[model samples]
Target: MRAVIFRLMGVIVLMLVGAGLVGWWFGPLPAALVACAVALVVIGVDTAAQLRVLAWLKWPRHDNIPTARGVWAEMLYRAARQLRLWETRVAHEEDKLKRFIEALQASPNGVILMDASDQIDWCNDTAAAHFGLDPKRDLRQHAVHLIRNPEFFAYMGAKRFDEPLLMRRNGSYGPLLLSVQIIPYGEGEKLLLSRDVTQVERTEAMRRDFVANVSHEIKTPLTVIAGFVESLRALEFSIEERDHILGLMQEQSDRMRHLVDDLLTLAHLEGDPHQPAEERMDMRQMVERLAADARALSAGRHRIKASADAGGLRGARTELTSAFSNLVSNAVRYTPPGGEVRITWRVLHPDYGDPYAEFSVSDTGIGIAPEHIPRLTERFYRVDRGRSRESGGTGLGLAIVKHALLRHQSELRISSQPGLGSTFSVRFPLARLDLAKPGQAAGAPDAPRADRESISA
Candidate 1:
């Protein structure tokens, strides 16, 4: 500003000197006064132009900024240079904010922001799903009011967020756990986070059940063995009594062995990531062999029959045998005396669909209840625990069947109705089934009326 004043002073001085020199050569007083007035007008115009530049700084834009001469033009250039620097900084900040929002959107966990009044400020898509809330529609709604879970409301009211809240994903449904936490942040604001913990809780429950079941199963046999050993040591017994006890002990030992073997099979199936070996297996011979085993297991108490229409399947031969044998053996064991257990294998294809194969085991026994049918394939799941145990079942047959079928990219489907009997079937994928083979080209043309019974299983 001082430099500007000095420059103005120099201009005034030069104007005076020129005017004085002209006036000295012509009319002295009047000419000098006129030149001094002109200099004052020039100074006023320059000051006004500077004022316009200062006004432009308040809400700066390029189009409205006036053209200027001399020092005023220099001031405008400087102002424009500073504005560009500020624009770059602002652009960088905006870009960073955009990236931050994208990162939150991509996060697997749900995140929500709330204001001091507990009103929703912003939320990601995951938060929307976790809370069953719409991101745009629910903005500014009260967090507690919107979530509406009693526990969630209590959590908000208590202002105690050290521990997270756990609730079911479907509040009306069975336990499918969700974890929610609130973190207090700046100026009474909070950050709410939620995660789906259903699988974790499921695993924990299964672990507890597995441990309890294993302990009980092992302890039953151990107790029987121990009791007999104690009897032999602590008291004298007759030869017949001793033999009876020994036989009972051996039966318990066999039961324990079967349980251990099933458990090991499950462990092996779960641990091995590689696919089962592929080998072509003829369904006819396989069914016959397994049917023979079923009859032996049944001890002629229940009638057993089997028919095969499928040519072959491609999978591990041993795995297929184990799975099929389990199904057949289960049917025989579960059937009452004089009841019939039937097994069938046939190729299935729609008019326009690729060919696949299905194997089913059906038994005319005490049919499973509708409720129990869904859980039949679960390990140790039973329609009647006493009946399952009495039938000499380890309760792992269906589970093994399920796992084996899964390895073949298939599923065990069960259909049952009380007093009507149950059917368990596995539908193999086209990739695992061989629709054509040398033998058994003619499908089950002479199949029984019951064999043709159509049910989902």
Candidate 2:
């Protein structure tokens, strides 16, 4: 405004000077007209220059005050750029997190994520399946509400993040052994991991049962041996009586020894599941030796027979011998006084296009129930505890067979009907079986001898 006023004043001053000069040089009318035209031109030119300056001033400078709309537009652009960068970063991070969560969902173990407020923030498919939860709907719910176990609830309520909680979850699927762990994450967040340990728990239970069964088995044998020892010590007897007592003690001691040996064999087999297969043993000779041992162990109480086609197996000789011996011994032990035990070996073709050495020990003894067949390989599981004791069984024979079969990558199958006797077969994979040397015969010379007198027929 000040500059505009100064320009106007200068224009007026110039007009007065021009009018005076014109009047001095010419007549008054002509001078006046000339002065007015000159002043008007000068004023118009000044006004136009001032208007240009004002237009330049109105255009924004680098550091000049900006219009409200301009400032708002710039702010909005920066905000949008920042938001785009943030959104991109979030999407990238979310994609990575989604892959990690998908992997967790596919894992066999159950997993759950909880927030700082002890609420279930997220859970994988396995965890949802184990808990029988609706994955889409149950998010953000309290974990305690879903898993209603008292122990787990107490553990979560106590804020004890250090120790994991062990509990059982009963769901529509079945009972599941659950191990729950809670960990503190960033800021106020928490992470929870759950694992189903049902199989492990079952194995532990079986171990406990085995220990108890062994204790009971050993106690009974020791009691019998102790009673006989006491009886011998209490009375003065003839040479025949003394010999009889010593023989009985020897039998008890032998039974104990056999039991201990079997237990040790089972332990050894379990320790090394992947033993080297350097030795190729002849199945025919092995069966022969086993039959001889079985016959001798039976003591003329039962007839024994051996039959085999042609097949040798590659495995630890000592382990294979122990396994075959256990099978034959089990058969002989279970067979009645006049029953017959048969050992057979043949090459079998399975549906999986694999050749296997099928070795079977069939006995005319009291058969096993169908329900009990599955658990027969478990340590110390017995169909007839009293009969097993009377027959001097340690109850670990089949257990040893199981471990041995596992080492050989073989399968043990037991089929029996009550009173019809049983057949226990161990099928060895072809990879583990080797043919005997060309010169060697398929059958052993020391095959079991069947005595007609001991035959039930």
lDDT of each: 0.83, 0.77
Query: Which residue runs of candidate 1 sit more than 4 Å off their true CA positions?
Result: 1-17, 26-28, 31-35, 63-65, 132-134, 137-142, 145-150, 167-176, 436-457
Score candidate 2 by TM-score against the native: 0.69
Best-performing candidate as measured by lDDT: 1
Ten-residue segment with the worst summed lDDT in candidate 2? 448-457
On residues 246-334, what C-alpha lDDT tens digit does candidate 2 reach at each position?
88878878887888888888888788646756677776677777888987999999988888765567888877777888889888988
lDDT tens per residue, model 1, 240-295: 99899999999999999999999998877777899987988878778788778888
Best by TM-score: 1
Total clashing pairs in model 1 = 0
Model 1 TM-score on a 0 to 1 scale: 0.86
The list of candidate 2 runs beyond 4 A from truth reads 1-111, 115-118, 149-165, 171-173, 181-191, 223-241, 349-354, 439-457
What residue pairs clash in candidate 1, if any at all?
none
What are the per-model numbers of colliding residue pairs?
0, 0
- Mark the 10 consecutive residues where model 1 has the least summed lDDT: 448-457
Write down the RMSD of candidate 2 (Cα, Å): 10.9
